[model samples]
Every structure is written in structure tokens, then in C-alpha cells.
Target: MTKQIEESYQLAKQRYAEIGVDTEQVLADLEKVKLSIHSWQGDDIHGFLFPNQELTGGIGVSGNYPGVATTPDQLSNDLSKALSLIPGKHKVQLHAIYAVTDQPKDLDQLEPSDFKYWVDWAKKEGVGLDMNGTFFSHPMLKDGFTLASPDKEVRDFWIEHGKRSRAIANYFGEELGQQSVNNFWIPDGYKDNPIDKLTPRLRLIDSLDEIIKQPYAEKNTIEAFEGKLFGTGVESYTVGSHEFYANYALTREKLWTIDAGHFHPTEDVSDKFSAFTPFGKGLMLHVSRPVRWDSDHVVILDDALIRMMRSLVRDDLLGQTNIGLDFFDATINRIAAWVIGTRATQKALLMGMLAPIKHLKEVEINHDLTERLMLTEELKSYPFGAVWDEFCVRNNVPVGTEWLKEVQTYEKDVLLKR
Candidate 1:
């Protein structure tokens, strides 16, 4: 595109080549890496389910940003705007609550027809679709549990809902020609200390077994279970803790979903990737920013995120990981939030790909600890920005902060009206 940017990329490419990194192949691989952008960010997690249905089940959104999508059409349109501003082809991850229907129906009653509009939209946009079972913000979760509820009736209802979600995910995969990931994350825990922690986990195991008993084509769907450290009300205990889900996923041969915000502040999710890869079938990552706790702030290009991306690349686990965003920040422009998070993720991946991993690995194997440490720190100051700007230019997106002007224009003409 711009002559100056192209010249800069050539210099950066030669510099990276000296380090045994192929810039062309890295950019090609980055183009193929698809990040599933969450739909909730466009609407502040308010799906078109019911009137006055507040967010419950231990999670909550914390702003009153205008132009929140209240209808399915609006949500789709807003997502399209955000996708256009980001690089590479991507997918939209949808919650079951976002289902558009003509008739009144509950979560268990939802079918692929209710999501036919999404399929049509995905087809038109040349994108894939992923689904999630909405286990929160409903009357069913009033007791702060769903699949792990002691009451058989409540547990059975959620079981049926999970089954339906799998079916929908299968349909999405079949229709879009990409395996749709159906992730299960339920808020089933106690705010205060409880004596019956074992019971709920046992019940959850049975419920999950029952839900998965109904077979769907494996090629069309990937079932994953997400765990939480704690939540708004579920402070004392979370039944779906990391230890529980990690063990269950390994035993059951399912994908393990790791939300960055769903762990202790000091914990690094990147460390868990290698540990889970050996036993688990695959990994699902919910990239989010957590401030002190599971605050679900909008993701920015931070140190932890860059490290996680580098780990995935270094370990060669990118192909086995289903990456998606899971933050809902209504404090700023919603569409801008989506663009910022998605681009930041891509940037991190680019930096990871540009790293001299092979050289560093050789140094480690040779027991040259001093060179290894020095090279690691030295690579950080490389011209990653030049290559990244070239990436944006090659993908036909705005370079640097140029995208912000488009977002501001959209906010003035589109978002402010609401």
C-alpha cells in the first residue's frame, strides 16, 4: 500500500531473517489463525431473551454505554462493523440467549431453526459460527446453580439444555463447514463456605455424562467445559474449579476451556497449556483482562497475553487451541472494545511468530543458560511494530491508530443515537 510502510517491512523482514525467522511464512500463518470474537461485547451481554432479565448467576456487566444492540439484526450489524476493522477472517461466538425466534420458547426448546439467521449471516460474511450454552441470567439460575443443582428437576432441565446446545453446535459446523465449539460454563457454587462441595461436583459429573450421552457427529462439534476460580456471589467455592475440569477433561477426552480471568491474579494460564496438552484432547482459551479479580475488563495488549501467545507458538499448540474473546466492557464504545481486543490478540500472535524460538530452544538444549537469558531479553526490542503495520496494510485494515478515527465516526453517527 504505502511505499514507506513497504520499505520498512522489507528492512524488518531482512532483520528477522538474520535470526532464522521467516517473515513471509509467519504472516501467512497469522492470516490463517482465526480468533472467535464474542458477540456479547456488542450488546453488553444482554441477549434478546426476555424483558427485564438481569444478568445473574455470579457474572455481571458494569456500564450503561449507549447503542447496545437490543435486536438480533443490530447485533449482527455491529459485529460486522467490528470484524471489518480487524485483520484476517474470523468467527463469531454466540450465546444461546442470543437466539432469534418468532415464537416463545425456553432454552431446552431452542433448535437450529432459531439460529438459522445466524447461519445465514455467517455465510454472507464468509465467517464461521461458534455457540455457547447460556447458563446464567435466567429464572433457572435463581438458586445460583444449574447443572450441579441437587434438585433432579433443575439438573435435568440444564442437562436437556446442554444437549440442545450440542445439537445447535453440530448444525453450525455442518452448515458452515467448520467445527463449532460448544463451551459449557455454569455458575454453580456458594458465596460462603459450604460443607457439600463434593455433592455438587458429583452431580455435575453425572449431568455432563448424561448430556454427552446423546451423540452428535464429532467432526461437526467440539465440546468444552470452562471452570472458574470465583465469581460475584460464588466467592467461597466454585464447583467447576480448574482442578475439577482439568481432571474431567483428561478423563473424558474433551477440550479444556481456560478463561484468563478465571484464575488467581498471580497464576499464568500459559503454564497450564503444556500441562493439559498431554492428556486433554484440545484446549479452548477465553482471552480476557482481569483486574485483581474476575472483573472481565476489555482485553489490551499486556505482558501476560503476549506470553500466552508465545507459549502457544513455541509449544506448537496453536493448531490445537480454540481461541476466543470473553470480556464485556460497557464503559467504552462496545464496537471499539471488540476491535481493540481482537487486534491486540492478533498483535500478540504476530510477536510470538516473529520470535527466534528455534535459536532459543537450541541454546537451552546446549546448556548455554547465559545466552538463552540474554537472547530472550534482546528479542523484545526487535522491530515488531514495522512487521505488524505491514500486516495491517497487507490485510487492508487501518495501520496503527488510524482505525480509531473510523470508530469515532461510527460512534457519532451510529452509537450515539441510542
Candidate 2:
């Protein structure tokens, strides 16, 4: 650790101590939090399934960055580089389409054997793996629906895919000794107003019931359902809207995934955390930055991000919430994007942990509204950066912007060559 960083941390430690917050314990707790890094960020959601498959199902990558990962090995290597620069133990979230195999297999035919390479790599890196059933960007989804399709044949194909994905996720959990979150999100909606939204929703419910009915150890695989507000073509209505999934998850006692970018631009996901925690079995968060519509921008240390983390901390939902990144930007260095987004998430968590949440809550309970508001505003100016720098140092990662140099060096020597 640098002399200046240590000095700053010591001072911040004393300041937090005065507010009944243990800085050392907070740092220790921060290390325990694992943020799942998304694999799609390295390759702009382009999976190595078949040659020249167009991005379908409301999926879009906005830039033509020169060095996007073109193969499974390259994507894994890029993720490794990003993980090296970030602090804390983390997991890598993968889609069904990222499976590496000698022979081409359709989504319905995918098996755990196809992702043996990923399990081996995660074991070597000492990280966990999460899985997702890719319901988008396939020939079956060209009509802009899956699992909720009116066509019986189309719905059956996606149902089989979801079943296999859960089985693969179960394998991941048993092999890695960590619970694998198998998230289900399908871009099923109408470009214009639909004649009958109720019919599609009923079909979706039936499809999910079948998928979840497949016998797998509940301890190994966690089934999570994600909902969306709107997407590129699905502007008028989204079948799996928040209201639909919230009710479904609560009734079925399943994990509900709340993506930050999946709601209206003005809606606060943090506010929903408390509401959902009371009824749902558990929660999974897809942390992303949304501009206007559901534009997945790289997350930064913004106010919304801070508030979200603070909500988790305040509601004591951090343990129940499975945190994961869900943004992919192809305009800049992909590795850099991963580092920046992951670090920003960690930084936000640190800020929340360092806050005098107990005291703030006590004040609120006592009906001291003015003091609560004052203390909240005052805590914002605390030396959070000092604690964050110390965290990076303790994790043996570069402090401040020092990590940028490493990313730049990597781009020059590694990414630019591609």
C-alpha cells in the first residue's frame, strides 16, 4: 500500500468510528460480496453458435469496436483480464449460446458437456459460474417471441431449451460448489398493441411451470425469472412486465430478477427491493445503466447506482440479492468496460457500507425527520474514495486510476493486435 493511501484510510477510519460504523468490518464485508460479471460485454452479445447469425429479439450492440472477442477462448481470456484488475472474488455469468463444442448443437440440444471448458476455466480462476437460457437472437425467435408463442411447436422448442439450461446450471452449481443462478428472460411482446395479452401470458405461465418442474436439486440451481418493460420492436407491450413477474414469483416462491434497465426511465429499482423482499423467495439484480429506453450503457458511480446499493444495505437485503452486471458497450475497450462497471458497483457498495445506516434508521424510527435528512446529506461528503482506495489496495488491485494504465497497456499489447 502507498503511504498516502494508508494515511487517508486511517483518517477515514477514525471519522466512521465516530458515527458508530466500523470501517474495518465494512471493508471485510465488502470482500464477501461477489458481483457476477456478464460474458456478453466482451463480445457485444454475439455468441459463437453459428456463422453470420443476425442479432434478433430486440438485441442490439451499438458500436463496431475493432477488438471484440470472436471465439469462446478469446471471450474467456478477455474476461480473465477484466477480473484481474477488479477487486473481490466474483462470478462470470454466461448465456446458453456461449457453449464451446466441436460440433454445432442447437439450443434445444445443448448439454452441460458443451460448457465443460467454462467450468474448468472457472475452477482454475477460483470463480463461480452462472447460467442463462438464451431465448433471443435465434432462428426460432425471428418472429419476436419464445416460450410465449402462440405456435405450439415454437413454444415447445423454447421449453426444451429452458429445461436443458437448468440442468446445465445444476451441473455448474455441483461442480463449482456454489449455487448457480439460472435466469430466464425472453423478449416476447408485440411491436404494436396485441389483440390478446392474456393468452400469451397464460402460455408463458404454462411454459415456465413445465421448465421448473424438471427434477433438479434446488440447493444447486436457483431459478430466476426476469421481466422487461419494453424493447426495440416490443414498444407497445411486454408480456413479462414487472407486475406480471412480481405476482408470479411471489405466488410460486421463486427468485425474481430485477434488472435496473428493465423499467421505465423514471422508475427506481431500489424502491422495489423492499417491496419484493417480503414475498419472493430471493432476488437477483441485473445492474446496468439505462439512458432513455432500455439502452444498456456501462455503469458508472452515478447517484442511481449509489441509491440502489444503499437500499440493499439499509434493507439488509444484500445477502438475499444475487448481484450481477448486465451492460455491454462495444464503443470502447471491452475489458475496460468490465473493469469500470465492476469497480463502480464495488465502490457503491463500499459507500453504502461505510454509511451510518444504523444511526440513520434509529433517527427515522424516532420520527426525527429533520435530523435524518441532515445526517443523510452530511454522510454523502464523507471520505468514501479513501476507503475505496484502501479496498483496492487490500485486494491487491491497482488503486485510483492506476488500473487504467494496466488496461491501456493490455489494449496496446493484446487487444489492438486483434
For model 1, what is the alpha-carbon lDDT of residue 133?
A: 97
lDDT of 2 by residue, 1-418 (tens): 5999999999999998988889999999999999999999999887877636888888888998778889877888999889999998899999998999889899999989999999999999999999999998888984788999999999999999999999999999999999999999999999999889899999999999999887777778888889998888999989998888888888878889999999888988899999889888989999999988778899999999999998999889998999999998999989999999999999999888887887888899999999999988888899989999998999999998888899888888888888
Per-residue lDDT, model 1, residue 152, is 88
- The lDDT per prediction is 0.90, 0.91
Give the TM-scores of the predictions, in the order they appear.
0.98, 0.98
lDDT of 1 by residue, 167-248 (tens): 9999999999999999999999998999988989999999999998877787899899899888888999999999999888
Candidate 2 local lDDT, residue 238: 92
RMSD of each: 1.1, 1.0
Clashing pairs in 1: none
Which regions of candidate 1 are displaced past 4 Å? none
Candidate 1 global lDDT: 0.90
